[model samples]
Every structure is written in C-alpha cells, then in structure tokens.
Target chain A: DTAVSQTPKYLVTQMGNDKSIKCEQNLGHDTMYWYKQDSKKFLKIMFSYNNKELIINETVPNRFSPKSPDKAHLNLHINSLELGDSAVYFCASSQGGQGGYTFGSGTRLTVV
Target chain B: EDKVVQSPLSLVVHEGDTVTLNCSYEVTNFRSLLWYKQEKKAPTFLFMLTSSGIEKKSGRLSSILDKKELSSILNITATQTGDSAIYLCAVINDYKLSFGAGTTVTVRA
Candidate 1:
C-alpha cells in the first residue's frame, strides 16, 4: 500500500470556485502536513497537524483551511480560489522526531 | 525565519561523471538535515544527517553535513541516466521541515 495517498491527482476549476483535496496515510505517523509547490518548484509548508491538533499555520490565506478528522487523514479546503492558487499540493506524513517524510503523489490544481 | 538555499539551481552531467550539490541553511534549533530525490512524482528520502562530518551513503549517492557552517553536500558518483532528478535539501528546525528551492540535475547518457 502507498504510505501516503491523496485524491484527485489533477484538478481544474474556474476562478472563485471552491474545491477540496483529501489525503490519508497508513504509516501510522503522528504528524501530517500540507505543502504547496509553485511554478518554480519551490515547496512551502502551509499547515501541519500533530495527531489531531493544529500545530503550524504559515500565514496562509483564510480561504485555505485544513481539517484533520483523525490522525490518519488531513483534508484541505480552498474557497474563492485565485489564479495564483494554481499549483501542486502535496500531503506528507512523518513520525515524531523522524528526519524524513513520506509524500503523496500530489494534486495539480489549475485555476482558469 | 529559517532559510535553506541550494546552489547551482540546475546542472547537466554525462553518465559516469560525478556531480556535487550544495545546500546552506540558517535556522534556529537545528535538528537534522535531509536530502531527497524527486522524479516525476513526490520526493523520496535519500539521507539524513545530524552530527557534523558523518557521511551517509546509499549506493552511488552520499551526503554529509557540517553543523558549524550550517551546510551540507550531496555527492552522486558514477552518475547514470536514472540519476536525473531534482535534489531537494531540507532542514528540520525544532519540528518543522523547510525545503530549499531544489537543484535539478539532468544526467545525460
């Protein structure tokens, strides 16, 4: 089984539309994170959840909210999306104190 | 704020040649430095270095970190076409992992 899995490998939506991406991990990791990769391939952390508690929020816009139903799943919801929101979103998970992370294939979001 | 910078944003090398990628970081509460190889999909872990001067090796890929300089180097020897990928360097500060812009390496056959 894939350690980390995400739904909707590709998404195309109109501006101002709302969409959601789902993620899950079966590695039994305690921490899960959301990262965005822009056109330049620069990956930036957006949010993190330890177990089910929100830990890091990197000044992301209010339109983007993350919800963790449980330790194994973290979902991202974006409302009123803009053209700048067109990027690849990745979901990753890691155990506490582990230096490496297991990443999902990523969802490529296109806003037109 | 934590900053991780990778040098030589991109490079092309012939098979059997050696390539070196550099990463410098500035962060507080440094925990560990990690190297990952990214192909068309998600990034995959390569090595993790905590103590300075200890080299971590896996096949043709190896990496070392220098805590004093706050830097790390990933070396790929006997490069093959399959070695072509974007190499990402990340620093773990406390519990957060911040990634660099990544170095794209293309190994030509």
Candidate 2:
C-alpha cells in the first residue's frame, strides 16, 4: 500500500482560479508536510502540521493555505492561482523526532 | 533565516565511477541532516545523519555528516545508470526541514 497518497496527479487551470490538493498518509505518523518544487527543482517547505496542529508556516503568500483535518490528512488550498503557482507539490509524513519522511507521488499544478 | 546549500548543482559520470555530493547548512537549533534520491516522482529516503563524524551506508550509497563544518557529503560508489537521479539534502531544525537546491546526477553507461 502507498504510505502517502496525493490526489489530482495533474492539474491545469486558468489564472485566478482556486484549487485544492488533498493528501493522506496511512503511516500512522504524527507529522505531515507540504513542499513545493519549482521548475528549477528547488524543493521548499510550505507548511508543516503535527497531529493536526500547525507547526511551521513558511513565508508563503496568504493565497496558499494548508488545512490538516487530522493526523492522517492534510490538504492545500490555493486561491487566485498565478503563473508562479505552477509547480509540483509533494506531501510527506514522518513520526515526531524522526529524520526520514515518506513522500507521495506529488501533484503537478499548472496555471495557464 | 535557515539556509541549506548544495554544491555542484549537476554532475555527469560514467558507470562504475564514484561521485560525491556536498551539502552545507546554517540554522539555529540544528538537529539532523537527511539525504534523499529522487528519480521521477517522489524522493526516497537514503540516509539520516544526526551526530557528526558518523557515516551512514546503504548498498553502494553512503553519507557522512560534519557538525563542525555544518556540512554533509553523500558518496556513491561504483555507480550504475540506475543511480542517476536528483540527490536532495535536507537539514532539520526543531522538527522543520530546510532543503537545499539538490544535485542532479546522471550516470551514463
């Protein structure tokens, strides 16, 4: 079974449209994260949630919001997507105090 | 701001060659460093180094961390074409990870 799974493997939308990406983990992990990978392949952490509590929030714009319904689910909602929002978004999960993380296949978002 | 930097953004090597990838970081409340190999979709965890001067190994891949230098190195020995992928380095600080730009390695047979 896939430890971490993300929906909408590919998404293409017009500018200013809003969208949401869902992530689920069955690893029984307490910590989950959302990362963005740009065209240059630079991975940057956008948000982190531990047991449904917001732990880390990077300097991302307010347009992007992360909601963790529970320890097993974390979803990202982007408002008014722009060209810069085109990138690959990956979801990951790990136990607290652990170093290794299990990642999902990633969702590719394209804003045209 | 916490920062992680990786050297040699990209490298090309022939099969059976050995290659080393470097990662350095600057952050407060440092905890550990991790190495991951990304082939196409998701990145697979390779090693995690918490203490300095200790090396972690798996198959032909190995990595070591140096706290004094705030750096780490991942070495691949006798690389095969299958080893070609983007190597990502991440530093953990207070449970949050700051990732480097990553090194792209292409092993040609």
Give fnat (model 1): 0.64
Most accurate candidate by TM-score = 1
Q: In order, what DockQ does each candidate have?
A: 0.74, 0.75
Clashes of each: 0, 0
True contacts kept of each: 0.64, 0.70
Highest DockQ against the true fold, candidate: 2
Minimum summed lDDT over a 10-residue window in model 2 chain B is located at B90-99
> What is the C-alpha lDDT profile of model 2 across B2-106, one tens digit per residue?
899998999999999999999999999998899999999998989989999988989999999999999999999999999999999998887677789999999
Question: How do the residues A1-112 of candidate 1 rate in per-residue lDDT, one tens digit apiece?
Answer: 9899999999999999999999999999999999999999999999989988898999999999999999999999999999999999999999973566889999999999
Give the clashing residue pairs of candidate 1, or none. Answer: none
> Which residue runs does candidate 1 get wrong by more than 4 Å?
none
